[model samples]
Target: MISLPLLSHAISSCNGPCRDLNDCDGQLICINGKCNDDPDVGTHICGKNPPPPPSGGRGSGCSQYGTLTCGGSAYPTYKCSPPVTSSTAAKLTNNDFSEGGDGGGPSSCDGKYHSNSERIVALSTGWFANSSRCGKMIKITAKNGRSVMAKVVDECDSMQGCDAEHAYQPPCKNNIVDGSDAVWSALGLDKNVGIVGVTWSMA
Candidate 1:
């Protein structure tokens, strides 16, 4: 049961933090455990939150943490910090679909995988570790002045040369922004092999 004071608080504080659905009042919804003022009415869930962390479930650490690989599967199973909304300069590249790199057959964000689609992108472990940014939207701008908005769908494996944050060591030769075939075409790059200097930002 909801009390008068609780209901008043919930109604007046629709955008405030919450622990459960009941914390929100009226049409407002509890999302990512927080009450959202402008939630996706269709889904009744805060549209900002990701689709939950990798198969291992949510983590409680920093976004720079790495993942674990077991039994031929890779899981970004580290405690994650809050997602960062700041934009960063990233080196974009295309991933060959020869292997199940689209987040291991299914997208880590929405659990849907489209091999030939270009609306999806894979971020490095450092970026993906911030679970909040998983399903968040990102704007990518190519050097050619073409820009596209993409959703973060998968985590680019550091072992496969996705580590690009090394300051002194010069990263694994790539920051590895793995985009879908459509992304490559949108950036006007050849899908066979290409690199583009791009900037990305999250809202």
Candidate 2:
């Protein structure tokens, strides 16, 4: 049977914590396993509280503690835990490219592989034309397995060994490297090559 507080017990006050127990009637105030009649019991906890640390999940720890490579070809496992590897990342380069209606020629990029390249400028030609391609991200891999993302720029028109405006001949000149000689020299592509492959996502 359960016990109910009498009319007199209801008016009593509890001065401490209330505990859950057997054989207690109504809201019993239990101070270290004892009950009181003071009404304000177990309400105040005084101290300073601090913000919580980040929870365990993807992308959170990296931002605070800086970036980390767990199972990359270079890092290859952190604390012996295998991370998901990207088996296929898009490749960018132009090699032996012929003139197409898209307006471009072959590039001297013979054996080079590039992925998402970063960019200095926020606005890029590809992205303005196609919002699907928002960022200037590129990744390149060397034969020795060295890979990094390069920045995208307005130099899509600045081909391997050419000027920025295709020597100002025609706006439709398919010669990207015709004016950007210095950049071409940097990439080590000769004028003989006609196509460079740049893989940018549509969105």
Candidate 3:
């Protein structure tokens, strides 16, 4: 149930501060504390106000987000995600920071490969804030009531991917906290589940 006045206000104020997705209008979404047009609005699946697909085309895969294909596989893409809060809700995904692993090149913050034994993470593009959060630590809390402190060592890019630098992976969802194995171990999570819901805040 959205109010017309709020929608009008949001439509009139692109880039204005927003508390969440409801504060945005039309195809706009909240990102990094502001409302902006979703870059993948029409292109991605499960997007708000999406236009109809081509008449005879196959449906978009996995009714959650857009997809990018590489090496004969489709990976999800997200141009905008939920706004950040003090205890920001995010998706925690696994990452291997060791050299020759799926993490690809060295970390963006320190240009080094960390061990899976280290508690580290890669934030999404917006929360990474152009490396502003680099080298900092965050507290992650899982649904099972376990928590751990992990360092921010890299960025799970939200804007660009499916290339050599990104290990041919798609752009990350804007609400990702790509954590190392040590972080999962500390939280007593089964990394085999792949992605899980979590809340995080600066530590």
TM-score of each: 0.47, 0.21, 0.65
Give the poorly placed runs of model 2, Cα more than 4 Å off. 1-124, 128-135, 140-148, 155-166, 172-191, 198-203
lDDT string for model 2 (11-51, tens) is 22233233432222223334564444213422111213322
Candidate 3 similarity to native, TM-score: 0.65
Worst 10-residue lDDT window, candidate 2: 73-82
Highest-TM-score candidate: 3
lDDT of model 2, residue 130:
29
What are the per-residue Cα lDDT tens digits for candidate 1 across 54-76?
Answer: 34333422332223323444433
The model with the greater TM-score, 1 or 2, is: 1
Clashing pairs in 3: none
- Tell me the alpha-carbon RMSD of every candidate: 15.1, 25.9, 13.0
Give the TM-score comparing model 2 with the true structure, all chains together.
Answer: 0.21
Deviation (Å) of 179 in candidate 1: 0.7
Alpha-carbon runs more than 4 Å astray in model 1: 1-87, 96-104, 159-174
